[model samples]
Target: MPRNYASLADQSVFPSISDLPGDYTCPETGGGVFGCLLVEIVSIERITRLVLRTFDRADSPVTVAFYTGDRGRSIENDPKLKPGNTMAILFPRRHLFLDGTVGVRQEHYGYFKV
Candidate 1:
């Protein structure tokens, strides 16, 4: 079957990350319970490109990328992903190759921690 891509201009059809299961809790640092950092989807180009950013913890800020059709679902079926949506993501502190590259693997949606 042919894949159906969603239009980025339409915000209603965007995917929601809230229920797309995966651990998003930030790892503990210095016994202070850093918790998960809230990140926002800064950019998205349909299903081809995705960029996320965390602003508070600038010391070890989080800036991740999802590229080149790596996102498991087409844009239409993708979770409620939209620019400016604040999210919490967790890093597995590991790496895997879904497409033969040494990259952090998202169990779902290219490894989005949220």
Candidate 2:
């Protein structure tokens, strides 16, 4: 997996993440700003080239797991998923948030192509 700590920390587009908005929030957990902090997918070719970025930060040992969908299971697990496709990720944050912390919890949602 590729890490983008320097780029995420510097708020710049590095090899790790990109195409992030200036002010973005998690659609699910409403957490802090998420940039291209992760390396989501690698190409299926011989070199395993990458095509997607994640919201996870560098220095974080990450794993990319795949799931197969059974009929009538869930929208995400649909069997019609194509190769090099994208999906939305929603996660929560405890500290720094795009929205102020109060009764308002923080969550983030973004697309990761596989």
Candidate 3:
């Protein structure tokens, strides 16, 4: 789906990739620690998962799982989601995982841009 970026231009405070803390789990963020990150696509896997890299750290790559119960199927179908493409993503509130990979379970299409 196409997006009207004008509507998305609110000055809502967004955290940088380096600012994402892993100490706690996201519990219905209410109004905290929200917003998407601008990241580069490092690699794609199985057409549904992705390995992404933040500009802040080349050594650290985050694995993104896009299986939010068909909520993310559009992401899997997007041709632009390939290596070297840049995209904006709002990960699920629980951005951190047990394996140390950070990713998305985004249920809203508005929060993701391909």
Query: 5-108 in candidate 1: lDDT tens per residue?
Result: 85644323322222122333334632223223345555443435454433322223334445435554454345667666655444332223354322223344
TM of each candidate vs. truth: 0.35, 0.23, 0.56
lDDT of each model, Cα atoms only?
A: 0.40, 0.30, 0.54
TM match of model 1 to true structure: 0.35
Which ranges of candidate 2 are over 4 A from the true structure? 1-30, 40-57, 68-110
Error of 2 at 24 (Å): 17
Tens-place lDDT per residue, model 3, 66-101, is 545563554665778777876776642436655676
Indicate which candidate wins on lDDT.
3
Cα RMSDs, all models = 13.6, 13.2, 6.3
Each candidate's number of clashing pairs is 9, 13, 0
lDDT of 3: 0.54
Give model 2's TM-score versus the native structure. Answer: 0.23
By TM-score, the candidates rank as 3, 1, 2
